[model samples]
Target: MYLGSQEMRTVLERDNGTIQKNLKKLTFYYGASDLWCPVQYYEDIKKDFPSGDIRLCKKGIQHAFVTSLTSSREMAAMIRDWLKDDLAEM
Candidate 1:
């Protein structure tokens, strides 16, 4: 499901503000490498949600970083730690 540039622009302009406002109440984890989605996208999202956990892998992992068993385990562990910390604060 891909939206064209114009469609995406319209959707973002209409909805991004609401999304950004609501993000303050949620904990977000975003991981991106130099491989698939450009690091800039993550950076932009980080700007939108300063409290989010935005991790950028300088090693340039593939888009499917979690497909490998080891990578999946590591990802799971990272999320587990984040959730623990988040829950602890509540």
Candidate 2:
């Protein structure tokens, strides 16, 4: 399965609530650089998801930085690298 990137239709419909709940049991490594999800959502999700490992990337830029190139590619890459590192620990 893909590490990230959910189906747009399901995401727009908020069908991911159940999946989000399920993911509560799994580790989470959020991009501190995220604009779309943001740190607020990450904090909220972490609150409900205490069972899993929680972390954030202390990098620069917005959420789209990962998928976008504009100056923040390195920051996004750092976030992705952090995710990989954390996942390996899991």
Candidate 3:
């Protein structure tokens, strides 16, 4: 995840337009109590990318949700369901 995230960040940093273009169609899910990410970052992202679908986790899952199979499954299912409409159109 770290390597992929860094690579993607590098690509996006090369062009602000690229970030904006892709971000416009993104749905970001941030943990409500994420220790790695402060709440202010989430607030700022919402303001910065108003067109993006940003949401806070309401299921009480910690930032390290991948550590638990149940949390991972739940998040995967939710994301798949969320993208179903756009995926179908594609």
Candidate 4:
């Protein structure tokens, strides 16, 4: 069950062209902080999908924000708001 670098890249890397082609039909809300995963990844995604909702937490929230009840609630609220706004547009 251990996937090495190539396997991981194959599983994770998206074809930018394909994603761009379908971008109009997709709704995304991506959040990333500099604490765990690289902030540049999210930035790149924002660049690729300019219309997509992406939140970069400069305050350095941990990657495992859901481990605490308070953080989980905050995350849920954020998602709920995003969902509401997305639904309103459709």
TM-score, every prediction = 0.61, 0.45, 0.72, 0.63
Instruction: Encode model 4's per-residue lDDT on 51-71: one tens digit a residue.
Output: 855567654446667797877
Give candidate 1's error at residue 70 in angstroms.
Answer: 0.4
For residues 10-82, write the lDDT of model 3, one tens digit per residue: 8552244765889857777888888867777678788877777888888988887889999989988998888
Instruction: Name the top TM-score candidate.
Output: 3
lDDT value, candidate 3, whole model: 0.79
What is the RMSD of candidate 1?
A: 4.3
RMSD value for candidate 3: 4.2
* Candidate 1 Cα deviation (angstroms), residue 86: 0.6
Error of 3 at 53 (Å): 1.1
Choose 1 or 2, whichever is better by TM-score: 1
Q: Which 10 successive residues of model 1 have the least lDDT summed? A: 28-37
Please, what are the lDDT tens digits per residue for candidate 2 over residues 1-90?
243555543456323467466774555567776756678867876686665567676655555654667647686565588678868989
The order by descending lDDT is 3, 4, 2, 1
lDDT of each: 0.62, 0.63, 0.79, 0.67
Residue 5, model 2: lDDT of 56
State which candidate, 3 or 4, has the greater lDDT.
3
lDDT of 2: 0.63
Report per-prediction Cα RMSD to one decimal. 4.3, 6.5, 4.2, 3.5
